[model samples]
Structures are given as structure tokens and as C-alpha cells.
Target: MSPAPWDSEPRAQGPTGPCGLQFRPRMDMAKLEEARLFIQSMDYRRTTWQDDDGDTILHIYTAKGQREYAFAAAERLQELGRLDSKEHKGKTALLVAVTANQPEIVQDLLSLGADISMCDIKGQTALHLAATYGFPEVMQVRGRERMPLSTCLTPLHCAVISHGATMKAPTSVQGRHTWLVSLCQLVLSLISQEIKSNKTALHLAVKDGNIQLVHFFLKQPLPDMQAFINMKAHGHTALHMAAGLHTSLHQEDIIRLLLTRGADPSVRNLENDQPAHLLQSGEQGEKVRRGRGTSLVGECS
Candidate 1:
């Protein structure tokens, strides 16, 4: 049998510094082809080689964007009982593919029975990485499975946190509005999943000044709205958080949305401060109060 890829010796070179310059010996194509043929013949022993970092050939190929090669290697490796082998950092080939945003490779690995729930040392799963990187298509594939309740965060939290300011306002077109509403529904579904934090996704949305997301929550059925809308943790509602952001451009709109949807403006936080008290003392506060009428805060109180 040909020498394994790892067994190829490095050629010695002249010392470049305290350490000698050791040049890596290139693999002879003839020998590599021989190994490939051996692997094709189901020689599991030779094909299961791992590097010093514990990355199998499948990991290397998948991370290098060698899609076809990675697929074939994955098949062989899976059969040989090494498909999900992890590297030094506890990253599997599937995690690497997701982080690299290689959807095709990710799909191939999933078909090969890669564990979608596997997380890295940092507790980030493939779904977490996909959401954090804004790869919604990849997220759709991995998200079909019921995800474990993420200890610190869910994909919904990651998606909202990673959301950029570039999202344009929906036009008056009915189709676009419908599509946006559907997308928001998906987000809400994600948000409804259990998380470890006391603060809900709406709290994060309000803190981020995500008016669109806040508006979506307001539009849900009253029962669902009551479930999440006025949710209080740390003694603050979404309204309190929005009201506290004196610099938010969308503050008035968000506050109005919350109040109209049954948010209690009179609710006090841990600091014993009401939402109206959190509002800025100036024309801005008067402007918001004026737009909604004097009864806005009074009626809620």
C-alpha cells in the first residue's frame, strides 16, 4: 500500500533562524492516485487517517471548498466510521461547512447523517452560525429539525442581533407586505422557542430599536400578543425599554404601537419608573403624547 498522506516526510532545508527551514514534501500524484483507488476499494484502515489536529480528510476537503472531493470523502469516511470526527477546536466538518457558508456542502453532509445538533466548544450549533452569519437558506435546512433550547441564545436571538440597518421599509404593495408579515411570523415562531434568559426576544427587539419586529408582534392575535407583548423581566416591559431609549428615532412609533396593542404605559419597572416617566422631557415627549392624545398615558394608568 502507498504511504498515507500524513506519512510523507518533509525535506530538510537550510536553517532560516533558530529553527531550521523545513520544506513540506509534495505528495506524488501517482501515490495519491493509488491511495484514492485503495479508498475506493473500501480499505477503511488507510482512508481513516487524521491529521495532528484530529481533522479527517473529510474535514479538510469540506473546509477547502472541494465540494465534489468532500462528498466522496464523506461517503467513504461515514462508511469507515469517522464522518463526524472533530478538529482540535471541537468543530466537525458540518460546523466548518456552515461557518464557511457552503450550502451545497452543508446539504451533502446532512444527507450523510451529520449531527445537526452538534455544537463547537463555544456552544454554537450549525443553526447558530447560520443565523449569526445571515445564511437564512442554510438555516432553513438545519432549522427543520427541532433545535435544542440553546443555553445562552437561540437562532432567533442571533438573527435579530445580527440584523443590519439596511432593511428597507416595505412598500405599499400588498404582496410585499404579505411576504414581510410571513417572514415576521417565522421570526416569532423562532422567538417562541424556549430560551434560558429572563428577557424575551421582544425585549431585545425593542432595545435594538427594531420597529418592524415590534410592529409584527403588535399585529399578532390578542392572545398571542398578551403572551409576549407586555412580558416583564427585570421589572421592565417592552414599552419601558423603548421609552428609555431617548435617542431612538423609532421610539415614538414603537411606543405608539405598544400602547395601541394594549401595552400598559402605566406599568412601573424595578426602578419604580413608568414608561411615560422614562420618556424624554422636551418637545419629543410632547410630540409623542400629542400624536396619541392626552388619554394615551392617562387611560392606560
Candidate 2:
């Protein structure tokens, strides 16, 4: 007959059951009442009543941002040894909460003993999703709860790799750059952690020609800042990457920052080529070489 009132909201669309029943969305009072009654009548023992995608009642509520129902269902699920249950996509309710941007539901699920360590089929944890999706509030919640930052890629790496134009908005609106800088400040120790190819966040930023990112990493008050700026990926330092990048408008700026911040120009790569040797010819390259030579001479004397 007619579509449900909550169906108009994109976030309200959830997995359809065999009966074609969809979960109610937040702010739909009448449908919420119906869902509340349905949840109350649901037999906690019969926990396998999921939709085609293997999402249980808990998954639906969390996905729809039904805070109170989701919280109660989470508590019941926790007691029944199902608080961390996964759907067909390997996403637990906690993961769904983060994806839904329901930070309040996220906090509640975590408090109800949801497994913070749970990852999706892609092996991305809740923290990774939060960072990749630019949900600083979710990240802040994890930080406030003192959640360990120990994922393989780490949240810092995810933020850097996923940052793009959409995240470049003004700082007042939580731009990606501002969000990444805040994360760096919060987890300075994790900044140096590398991913595949031994590429640290600095390496990725430099490779992406992100001058602002390079500047932020270099400016951190790490104990051994030189070692950080010079971290290698496939035997190439960030300085080497910067030197090799000739097309980016920020290329010279990146190279200059790396040199001034103790990047060892004399350091050789796998082929024994120093950053200066990788530099292209002409005015810009000459400026970089001059700065590199000066830094080297200063280091030597």
C-alpha cells in the first residue's frame, strides 16, 4: 500500500526481512512505538531472527539510531552472549553504530561491553571506520574511553590515506586536515607506525604531495624528529619522495620543510641515490639542492 514514514530518510532504510518489514527510523514516533512493542514482544531466546543480510534486531536498531531501544537490546544481547554479534558483512552492532554516525549509540554499545576490537570483513576496526569516515566525535569517544590504538593500519594511517577534497573544508566545520592534525596531536606515539611497504603516515602524505600533512608531522615534538622525517619506504625517505615529485605545486615546499627539519640529504636509497640526486634539473630543483647542500654542510660541520 503506502511506504512507511521513516522510509523517506536515507539512514532509515535497513535490511528487509522475509516479511518485507523494515526497521523504524529515529523521529518517527508512530513507527517507533510499533518497533518498541515489537521489541518488547520479541523472545530474547530466539536471537536468530535476522534479515536477508544476517542483521539481527540489535543491528537494525543501532543502524537506525534508535538509541533507547538499541541500548536496551544491547544490554539484553550482552547478557545473552550476543552483544558483539556480526551481520553478514562481519560488522558488529558497534561497527554499525559508527557507520550510522550514532555516536550516542556507539558510547552505549561500548559501555554494554561491545567488542571494540571487532573489525569488518575488510579487517577495519571501529576506530578505522571512524577515522576513514571523518567522524571525529566517534574518535574522541574512543579516546575518552582510553581505547587502545593498535590496529594494523592504525587510525592515523587511515585518516591520512582517506583524506581528500571533501575533508578539506574549513576548520570550524571539522575539515579533514584539521581532523587529521587533531588525531596526530592525540596519538603522537602512533604517528611513526608504518603500514605495508614500511610507509609511515609521513611517507603517505609526502607521496600524496600533501604539504600541510608533511608540515604537521615534521612539527610534532617527537623525541627523535630526524629519524621520523627520514623514515624509509622501500629504501626511500620522505625527502626522497619529495625530491622525486616535480608536478605538485607543493613539491618545493615539501622538500624545503623536509630539509630544514633534519632530513638527511646525504642519506641514500636502495640504489644509493640521495634525495638531491633524485631532484629534477632547473630552477626549482636547484633551489632544493642548494637547501639540501646547506643542510648537509651544517650537519657536517
Candidate 3:
């Protein structure tokens, strides 16, 4: 068999920049066979063929879709107590597999005892990457089982922010509603978990004017109604964000959802400004503020 593109010499730098790093190129059967043979002929345990970016042969093969080769390397590395080894960016094989959307490789890494909770330089875990990239399959990995609430906060935030108004439930059947409810429950649970910025997923959804997401969050059976409704980030509630978003065409609808769900529009932010004050001085804004006040009073009554 002829050599594949990956059989050529390693590039001087990765696509990200001129870091003088080299990574295995795209793979084919011939290159994979050559790599396997090379591994077999050498003291695979003591091989010094790491890329400039500190990626081991396992990392290279795992990322290149040479599944059999990657599995072989991974088994040997795990036996040698290096299954969780990180590349230059603190990316474990699991993180790489997750980022690459290689579910089979991800499973192999997890079964090999790769740490799922390991964070990169930015303190992002595999779950965070999965959620940020919208990979629900990766989120369900066995290694992620029983993850702590705090650890999932960023992933939830990522899911909400990344999804925005894009996620929708089809009106096909009861199963769709059930699935949507379950998804919303998961989203709400994560929204309650505080992140570094103290922002809930609801706050992000509102800020982005994701009407669909905001509605989903509001409809969930929340444990802490006061906390969920009045949760503040940067001294701004979801209501405040909805009202303050100048370009949001659905601001009125979002503001109404928050009010009905127990959001206190009268609550002031760090600037001592109420949600009503954030609205523009116009007929539409006035109408929304009046409607919000009426709804609040009705709820209280």
C-alpha cells in the first residue's frame, strides 16, 4: 500500500500559529500500518517520538482516527501508568477525543481511566468542551457519571449560551415534550449552580434574548424560587438583561415571562436602576413596564 498524507514529514507548526510544533497529519491505512510496525519494533515504553507540542504517539494516533493504532498505544501507555498524560495544552487523550468528537476513542480513554474532570489552562473540563461545542454524546460519557453540580456549571452555561434560540421541540408527540422537559430540567439544575462570574444560564439566555431558552428555564419546577427569579450577575437580573437588550425584538415577551415566573422588576441593580428603568423612553417600553407592574400585582394578589 502507498503512504498516506500522514506518512509525510510532520509540519513545522500547527494551524493555530507558528509555535514550531509538529503533529501527525491526516492518516490512512498505510501510515497506520507503518506506525503500528514502528511501535512493535521499538521499546514502545521508552520511545522518544513525541511531537514538539508534547503529544505522545497515543495522542497523535487518537486524534488522527487511527483507532486500532490509538487503542494499542493507549493500552500500553495505561499499563505504563500514563493514560492520563497531557499534551502541551494540558489536554488529556480524553479531552482531545471529546474535542475531536471521537466517541469510540473517548470511550476507550475513559475505560482506560483517563480523568474526565481534568481542566485545561482555561479551567475548562471535558464536559465544558462538550457543552460548548454542543456534543451531547460526549456529555453522556461514563466518566462523567455522578459529576458534581459545581463542575457542571460551566457546561450548562455553555449549553445555554451556545444554543440560544436555536433549540426547539417538535410538536410531533408526547415523547418530544417529555424529552424537552427533561432537557429543561437539566438546564435549570445547572443554572442554579453558580459560576466564576456568578451568572446563571438563565441570565445568559435572557442577555442573548433567547426567548425559547428563557421560557424553558422559567417553566421548570425550581427549588429556590427567590434565588432563581432574583439571581443577579454583575448586579443585573435576567429581567434587567432582557429589558436592557436594545436589539431584542422579543424583549417584551421575555420581560413578561420573568415577571410571571416571580422575577421582581422593582429590585435594583448596583446602579440602583430597576428593570423598568432599563427600558427605552418610548410607548413600547412604557407599555411593557406597565404590563409588568400589573402582572406583579396580580401574582402578589
Candidate 4:
């Protein structure tokens, strides 16, 4: 058989024989669609990075303060795949959710596959995180955020007292304070606990002068500090504590937000004094403003 002109001529053949296999590159739409469907069907958690500290995607997401994304990722991972099987640092997804100060997310994670009995590297569970941190606004964590809401009374107040008790003798409890990341999460816990009318997490953070926590709470969706400024414990919101502790930029802003939010300038306490009155009294008065009795003083005549 006579060879083709291209095959006969080495120059025309390019490198190999005439059959160089010149074919157009197809898009492979069918295979691409299959890959997309596979990704959509799989659980997000399965492909998530393993946290260095054994924290799960849920924990990192919560700590990151991505509320909507965190919950949605958890939901998607749960609905499409195994949720209870998820873990980080020997803790389950439920525990991570609680530690992140996400009571609602905690409940949802639990419904999927969370094991309440599971503990973290520090021997704590979701309940412990909820208790330790309390709610950002009310400082309550009675399981109200859960489904078929719990009948138990808010436990955050008790948790704080208990934690303090440990400090009294110097608990030497020997565990990680992993529930905290940003002061924002801590504040949220205090609020969920209905911890108002006492030294709130915001109040505590201010007294501690943790500027990071201060800024964090300020930017939150429902800031605990906004309603808590300048009032002496007898009358002092967080601003009162900041003024007495050592005022800073956020502290001043806290006062403005409180005022704008309508924190009553005329609201009086046992001293029969308003926030303005307390402010004018003296530095010594502001320093002594925070006390155990202050909680009661603010509550009643």
C-alpha cells in the first residue's frame, strides 16, 4: 500500500506518524456534573481541616464568630451525613457548639448526633461551657436555647459562683479555660444566663479592663455593655466600672451607646441615686460602687 504524502514525508509528519491523533479537547460536562453532585451529597465536616488542638469545624466556626455560617454548615453536615460521629480534641460537635456560646446550635447539633456525656480534653461538656460562660446579655444558660426547652433553672449564675468558689480555696481545678476565645463569646454566655442585676460578664470584663473583650462586645449583634454603662452597681453599668477601673476609648463609647439606647439616667438604686448622681459623687464612691450588696441594692429599695 502506498503511504500517505504526509506519512511519506518526515517533515509533514511533525514528530510521529501521520496519525498524530489530532482531536479537540472535550469539556467533559458529564464527568464535571458527576463531581459536583458528589460534592453536594457529601458532608462538609468530613473534608474540614483537623484542628491543631482537636477543635472541630463547629468550634473554630463559633470562635470565628460566624454565626449564620457556623449553624448552616453544621446543619448541612448533619442533614446529609453523620453528625454524632464528629469530634475535636476528644469532644463531640455538641460540646464544641456549647463551648462556642451557641446554645441554639448546641441543641441542633445534639439532635443530629451529639453525645451529651462526651467531655473535652478538659473533662467538660457542652453543659459545662454553657454554665461557665453564661449568656452575653442576660447571663443565663438554662437550656432555653434548646429544643423542647429545658425546665431547669438558669445555671450560669451558679456556675460563676461555683467557679469563684474554686478560686476561694484556689480550686487548682487543673483544666483548660477553652470556653473563651473572644470576650464576645464570654459576654454572650453571660446574657443567655439571665445574669443581669449582678456583676455581669460585661461588668466583669470591664473591671478586668480586658480591652479586647470590650471591643468585641461593642460590635456584637446585641451588646451587653450598651445597656450597662456608668450606673454604679447600686445604680453602675459597665461604664461605671470602666470609669472607676480606668476609662478608655471603648469605655467612653459604651457610655454613649447606653445613653442612646435609653439607659435611664434617672434610674436610681438603694442609694436613691441615678447614674449622673453616682458620677458626680466622687472617685472613691465609684471605686466602692461594685460590691456583693450592689446586686441587691440595684434590685430593691
The global Cα lDDT (0 to 1) of model 4 is: 0.44
lDDT of each: 0.66, 0.71, 0.65, 0.44
lDDT (Cα, tens digit) per residue for candidate 1, span 234-289: 78888888887789899888887777777776778888887777777788776765
Pairs of colliding residues, candidate 3: none
| Model 3 agreement with the true structure over 1-301: per-residue lDDT tens digits | 3332233434222233111112233334564575557566657444434566867777877676556567667777777778778889988888888777666677777777777778876677876776665554455544325433345355677667667322442223343234334444444463454556688878888888888778877776777766787988889888888888767788888887887778886788898887767776777666765774323322211
Alpha-carbon shift of residue 105 in model 4 (angstroms): 2.7
For residues 1-301, what per-residue lDDT tens digits would candidate 4 score against the true structure? 3321111211111122111211122223444354345435545544354445554445555444333344544555566564544454666666565655554455445545555566556655555555564432111232333322132223333344344433343122222122233222432444542324556555555666555544544555664543544334545566445544433444444444444544554556565644444432355444333432222124222
Ranking by TM-score: 2, 3, 1, 4
Q: Where does candidate 2 clash, by residue pair? A: 167-176
**Candidate 2 residue-wise lDDT, 22-90, digit = tens:** 333344556456555655666755444566787777888787766666766776677778888889999
**Comparison by TM-score, 1 against 3, better one:** 3
Ranking under lDDT, best-scoring first? 2, 1, 3, 4
Best by TM-score: 2
Better of 3 and 4 by lDDT: 3
Using lDDT, give the best candidate's number.
2
Candidate 3, which segments miss by more than 4 Å at Cα? 1-38, 45-48, 143-153, 164-188, 191-193, 291-301
Error of 2 at 134 (Å): 1.6
Off by over 4 Å in 4: 1-49, 79-81, 85-88, 110-113, 136-301
